[model samples]
Target: MTELALLVQGLLDGSIYALIAVGLTLVYGLLRILHVAHAALFTLGGYVGVVVTNETGSFILALVAAMIVAGIAGMIIYRLVYQPILHLPPYVALIASIGLFIAMQEGFRFYDEQGVSYVNPPVQGTLELAGQTLQLAKIVTFFVAIILIGGLGLLAAKTRTGVAWRATVTMPAMAESFGINIIQVRYINFFIGSALAAVAGVMVSLTTNLVEPTSGDVWSYKALAIIVLGGLGSMRGTLIACFALGVLEAFATTTCVPLGNIQICLGEIMNRDAIAFAFLVIVLMIRPQGLFVRA
Candidate 1:
């Protein structure tokens, strides 16, 4: 029962990671930029959502507003910072993003100088699954992730913007020859990715019921690891890796192994972040392309 509960919790956590990683992977696929500042967008979402919830006492409103704000911010960043460097070397953009990340982190620190922040879920209760109880907030988050991902997947497949994005990434010259506006595609993709990250921020805050200014920095690194482990540009790989890592972290944190009449607490030996990177190293060595990437 304990193992089952741990697995469930791990998968739920993984879902959030997957949500965050999807955005990171998508942006990478579109522009090949690391977009380190993406983390700040996540933190911004949480801060905005918390403030909105506090002022209006409406979780749904807060969620929508946060996403909109973050999405717009993402577009603005791309236009002001990335667009100017679009033709420059990738490393140049990477450096710019790093600077942007630090600036946004400090901005959050200045604004949210209060103590820790948290958001309350709109509904309460738990669902029993396979004799294990699941928090309503987690369930909502899981469903929301599935719905958003699915919708995005469909949009990518069917919409003109989606088709243009794929074509532009596949062959920028050919896409441009066909009159596809790569700039517009980039803007749309960045907006979608950033908005998704915002949703992840809000969901994560609801699940943990806590938020700090550093939350973005923490999850941003983990999200980067997730995308790398899942394969840089493969959405399917990212999802698979995200849950696998999540479950692995859960097991590490919760499962105690017996060894010759003694118990070993894996979680104590290495924290979740450490466990994630350990898996990352092994995966990189064994399968440099990632768990889901096939060469």
Candidate 2:
């Protein structure tokens, strides 16, 4: 029962990780740039959600507002920041992204240095599932991730927009030559990716019940690690790697081993974030191309 509970918890956490990392994967796949500022957008979403919820007492509205705000911010960032520097070396864009992330963090701090908490979370209480207690919000988060990610998959596989996106990714020049609006595609990519990140942000803030200026700091790097470990820009690989990391971290934190008269607790030895990076290192050593990248 304990093991089962851990597994369930791990899967729930993995869903959240997928929500956060999928946007990063999409942006990287389409733009070939590490959008460190994507973290800022995540933080921005949380703030928007909190403020909107508090002011209007509507969680659904908060979600919608966050998505709209973040989506527009993403398109603006792409046009004003990334588009101008994309002709330069990739590192240049990376540095700029890092700078933008830091600036946004500072901006958040300036807006409210102390951070904020939800006035009234929409979901409260726990649920009994398979003899294990679980937060209702987490369960909701899991289903929400499923629906959104699955919807994204369908969009990519079935929609004309998806076809255009794939064409742009495969051959931007040819896509443009064929009358596909490359600029529109890029804007749509950023908008969707940023919107997804925003939704993830709202879900996370709701679960935690707090929104801090530095909430996005950890994810900025961690999401990068997830994407790289999953094979950079591989959507399927990213999903697999997110779940794998979530389960590994869950086990590391919850399980202890007896060794030579001394019990070793993995969580005590290393923090959760450290465990994630360590796993990434071990995986890279074994398969440097990443878990799913074709050799």
Candidate 3:
């Protein structure tokens, strides 16, 4: 791929990461929990999308259903699992989240050990742009992510709900005293976050045409690295980190380096995940508080 093509591909990849990481950042910012079960929710969305699309042959309907179901599940998790344990140490909630993730994965495996795939994907074929061929599903995924992320930005910046969310994050006691419903804000946070994850999951399934029981495993780790690298709980930082990682990974995997007389691609040397985490480690060594966190 040409330089411009690689750049575009990286940005497109970043859009997906942004969708996944944004949810983690939001939940962490508000509740100070890692929410590892989010990955399971993502996988759940993919399975739901696959089933709905196969049954109804409507991709739009699948997306909507996945978002609604995942959003509701998120709210329930918050109310039932996290609420009672909020006063405990943060690690306690994190452990519970990990357990929930494992249990959900097992449940999915029990449901379909072989995983699932979309029988009638809504988008097909590819588009050539800037000397690169891009999948139509990926293009759709990019646009959907942009719309959702942009809408999230608008919600955070322009609405009364945004004000309440910010207040709750900064000063929950004061927010409640001032008539803001902290519980509602928390619920909204999880709903929006989980919904975004579901959309991402559906998009991934569409792009790949497959949804495995463990589809979200790799993403869960990458999302954790992204939120932490971006500065835990910092949405803007998370967005920046997502794109940065994407572009870096793109170049790392595709660009060839001259070693002696032979051209060696980094992809041949280290996989994309290793490249991402190596970058994270390098960045953290320099900026221990994270790329965007204030000292």
Give the Cα lDDT of each candidate.
0.85, 0.89, 0.91
The segments of candidate 2 whose C-alpha lies over 4 angstroms from its true place after superposition are none
Q: TM-scores, in order shown?
A: 0.92, 0.96, 0.96
Tens-digit per-residue lDDT, 1-295, candidate 3? 8989888888989999999999999999988999999999899899999999999998889999999999999999999999999999999999999999999999999989988987767788999998789998888888899999999889888999998999888889999999998999999999999999999999988778888888998887898999999999888899999999888988899889898999988898889899899889999999998899821
Highest-scoring model, lDDT? 3
Q: All predictions: root-mean-square deviation over Cα?
A: 2.1, 1.4, 1.5
In the range 1-295, model 1's lDDT, one tens digit per residue, is 5778878888898888877888888888878888889998888888788788888998899999999999999999999998899889999999999999998888876776652454444556789987888888887888899999999999889998889888887788899999998888888888888898999888777756666777887788988998899888888888998899889998887778999999998888998898889999988999888887622
**CA lDDT for candidate 2:** 0.89
Give the least accurate 10-residue stretch of model 1, judged by summed lDDT: 114-123
Stronger candidate by TM-score (1 vs 2) = 2
Q: Candidate 3: which stretches are off by over 4 Å?
A: 259-264
Q: Residue-wise lDDT of candidate 2 within 70-102, one digit each (tens)? A: 999999999999999888999999999999999
On the 0 to 100 scale, the lDDT of residue 106 in model 2 is 94
Candidate 1 similarity to native, TM-score:
0.92
